[model samples]
Target: MRIIGIDPGTGILGFGVIDAKQGGYRLVTAGVIKTPAHTPLDERLAEIFDGLTEIIAETKPEVMSIEKLFFARNVTTAISVAHARGVAMLTGHKAGLVISEYTPLQIKQTLTGYGKADKKQIQEMVRLNLGLSQVPKPDDCADALAAAITHAATTRLGVV
Candidate 1:
């Protein structure tokens, strides 16, 4: 199975793709779609939608796993991220991919066997799981890949 995981933000929408087979995972691609801070909000959202659509076309993933939006102290930031996440879900739905949402805690737990694991631990585990030389950069990208890994593990165990 091929999965696309997304960590959505207006300025930087992180994404990772992975293929799961034979009890192993292969990294297909991972990166962030960045929008300039100075760009208008509408334009940035459009950019995210368009870029995600293109990625879906190229990757043709069977499933999409995305981080569930969580509220922080900043309401404005949360709302913006929610909007970006909505666009991401819409793109996946349009592409006929099964969409699943996972929390950060669930991602950490599934990837590292610890729900309270720190970012570094989770990133390291993700690198080790995929046999990569180093953790994927920009934190968000690593988080995206972690989400994909989490989904793969969960689904393989019939938890999803």
Candidate 2:
């Protein structure tokens, strides 16, 4: 199965694609969609939507695993991220892909066997899980890969 993971953000949206099979998972691609900070909000959202739509078309993923919104502070930032997340979800839905959402805690727990694992730990786990030589660059990209890994693990265990 091919899965696309997304870490949605207004300024920088991260995405990773992985191919999972009976034996293991392989990285297909990983990258980010960045929008200029000075751009208008609507334009940024349009860019996100278009970028994600193009990604879904190219990857042809069977499913999408996206991070759920979890903001404890900064409502202004949270609202913008939520809008980006909505666009990402809409793109996936329009592409006829099954979409799953996981919280940061859930992703960390699944990848590192600890719900409160640090960023380094999650990045390390993702690297090892995918047999990558080094941790994926940029925090957002790694986080996106973690989301995909979380879904693959949970699906295998019949928990998702």
Candidate 3:
């Protein structure tokens, strides 16, 4: 199965594509969609929507795994991220991909065997599991990959 994972943000949306088959993973692509800080909020959102649509078209993933929005200390930032996430979900829906959401703890547990694992640990495990030379950069991108890996394992275990 092909999965596209997303870490949604207005300024930078991270994404990773992974293929899971025969109990292993094949990394397809991973990167971030960055919007200029000076751009207007509406324009940034439009950019995000267009970028996500392009990604969905290019990857044609069977499933989309996205990080669930948790309450954040900064309400403004949280709301902006939430809006970006909504666009992401809509993009996946329009692309005919089943979408799944995972909490950060769940992603950590699936990737590093501990829900409290640190970011470095999760990144290391993700790299090892995917047989990649190095961890994907920009932390958020790695987090997105972790979300995808979590879904892959959950499906393998028949959990969701």
lDDT of each: 0.93, 0.94, 0.92
What's the distance in Å from true for residue 33, model 2? 0.1
Task: Write the candidate numbers in order of decreasing lDDT.
Answer: 2, 1, 3
Query: Candidate 3 at residue 78, lDDT?
Result: 96
Model 2 C-alpha lDDT per residue in residues 69-123, reported as the tens digit of each score: 9999899999999999999999999999999999999998898788989999999
Predicted model with the maximum TM-score: 2
> What would the TM-scores of all predictions be?
0.97, 0.98, 0.97
Tens digits of per-residue lDDT for model 3 on 101-146?
A: 9998888888877889999999999899899999999998998888
How well does candidate 1 match the true structure in TM-score terms?
A: 0.97
Better of 1 and 2 by lDDT: 2
| Model 1, residue 40: C-alpha shift (Å) | 1.4
How far off is residue 104 in model 1, in Å?
A: 0.7
Span of 10 residues, lowest total lDDT, candidate 2: 107-116
Q: Which residue pairs collide, candidate 1?
A: none
The prediction achieving the highest lDDT against the true structure is 2
* TM-score: model 3 vs. ground truth: 0.97
